[model samples]
Target: MNEGIIEGFNRAQITDETLVKMRESSARDVDNLPIIRENSAALYRFLITALKPLCALETGTCRGYSAILAAKTAASYTDSFKCYTVELDSVNAQEAIKNIAAEGLTEHIKVIHGDAAEVLASLSGQFDIIFLDSSKSHYSEMLPDVKRLLRRGGVLIADDIAYYGKTEAGEVPHKHRTIVNSLRAFIRQISEDEDFTAVIDTMDDGMLLAVKN
Candidate 1:
């Protein structure tokens, strides 16, 4: 990956030394996987600066890397900013809570353990930013809830939009064909729906940044 392209995608204005330290320390503890390999700390930080969301929602809490980054960025912009993260795996959820706390972000984040869909259903207040990072197959099913939860003019940032069997057109392999089809449907909804307008960027897997219209 070219440095310019990566930095541009992240909307990085000035390179921060602390971000590098966080990444280095984070890599030492986290097991590298395909989904986890594409860390979006920079993107999260950019969003926090750009939107200054008072309340943010994340669908997945993996080791608390992104959540911590969001919280750190949020701390500078809003006095009451907080991130509510949902994790399906009990072990990951508990570990994520501890990890966020270890990063001194306990005051800015809350981890909810359970199915993200079920958790979203119980959420009362609207969020200014919604990050979709859970099971790729469930992304389509999460569309309605994401739309409902996001406030007017809010942004929805979805990662891994074009990967594995997921393509610009939502094509996928036979074994995971359903997920592919669902991804296509979800992408179409985001693109065609007048309620939202999206810009798709091919970086760190495909990233779709959609703002409510």
Candidate 2:
């Protein structure tokens, strides 16, 4: 976590004390599932503030940190805000529910327990913002549903697109080849798609931000 970036955003400008504490607490998770990095979380909070999205969808709700952040931030701007976050792991999903409750955002954020792709397929309404941060290999496979669920002019944010720099560096190790290749394919697919105007942010791993045209 960069103190300079935090100071630049200004804690008061981005989020409240409780959420900040939550972020810090979640940083020490025992299972070591990747939580959103500070810079990436800041970017998310900034986007939610800027966009004021009423309905946001998030995949990969690991302990509900990002979803809670989004819900709380959006709540500052609009009463209509609601976030639906999906998690595949039952234990993670339960933890997310508890964390959301702890944040007093249970009404604003829903933690759905299921496979991300299947859950996306079952969801019916359009989302103003859709975030993809689930399994790396599943990203490309989930694109069709993501495209379908996001409304026109909605924002799509995909995290960990660089696979910790493995996607860009030469000679990906054998074990990482699948994820690296999938992330590269996902990047290419979004970049070449006619309907989206996209850009990659290389801070804290990598994030792909695209607007549906």
Candidate 3:
């Protein structure tokens, strides 16, 4: 297989100097943390900038890489844009807060420390974008709340859905069967729902980007 051509064609639509730093910083913990893929991060910056969302929500706050990128992009459009990200682990949340501050996005990005379900339930404002990058097993469970919080025409982006490039509904590793099944179900629900227009972007790790009707 010619992987070179594949890489050449998956070009990024936008670029930012901070992205390289964030990518390098997060790469340090790639073994333990699920940091955003290079291509994924580029695409995220592109989409968020294009969307210019006034308010956004993200489920994962791993070291605040993606959250900071999102805040940077949103802030470029308007100073009032706000980003609220949820982190289930207290330690990760604390680290994310520090990183957000270091990036000088403390005013634009807010890290909420708690379970995604609980944090999402308490959220009061409708968002122009929602990002799902937390527990794979809970993506399905969190879809209802995501839908409730996402405004019409808003974007819902989920990462790592096509785990290890395996998205088909069938056999999976014993330990990962539940997560795979849940992801498959979530895909089906979003794809079949009349209110959404969704597609799976096979860039690097699989990304599911859907727009609410």
Q: Is candidate 1 or candidate 2 better by lDDT?
A: 2
Per-residue CA lDDT of model 1 for 55-135, tens digit only, reads 999988876767777777777867777899998888778878887777777888999898888888787778999998888
TM-scores vs. true structure, each candidate: 0.85, 0.91, 0.90
Candidate no. 1 TM-score: 0.85
Sum up the clashes in candidate 2.
0
Q: Per model, how many backbone clashes are there? A: 0, 0, 0
Lowest lDDT 10-residue stretch of candidate 1: 31-40
For every candidate structure, what is the RMSD over all alpha carbons to the true structure, in angstroms?
A: 3.2, 2.2, 2.7
Q: All candidates' lDDT scores?
A: 0.76, 0.87, 0.84
User: Among all windows of ten consecutive residues in candidate 2, which has the lowest summed lDDT?
Assistant: 5-14
- Measured with C-alpha atoms, the lDDT of residue 97 in candidate 2 is 94
Better candidate number, 2 or 3, judged by TM-score: 2
Best by TM-score: 2
> For residues 1-213, could you state the per-residue lDDT of candidate 3 as single tens digits?
344754544434335666666665656565356788767877888898788898999998888888888887777779887889999898889988987887888888989888887888787779999999998889988898899999999999999889986666567889888888899899989988999999888777799999999
Q: Which digits, one per residue and each the tens of the lDDT, describe model 2 over residues 1-213? A: 556854466444545776666666665564455888777888888899998899999999988888988988887788768999999999999988998898788899998899999999888889999999899898998898999999999999999898878988688889999999888888889988999999998878999999999
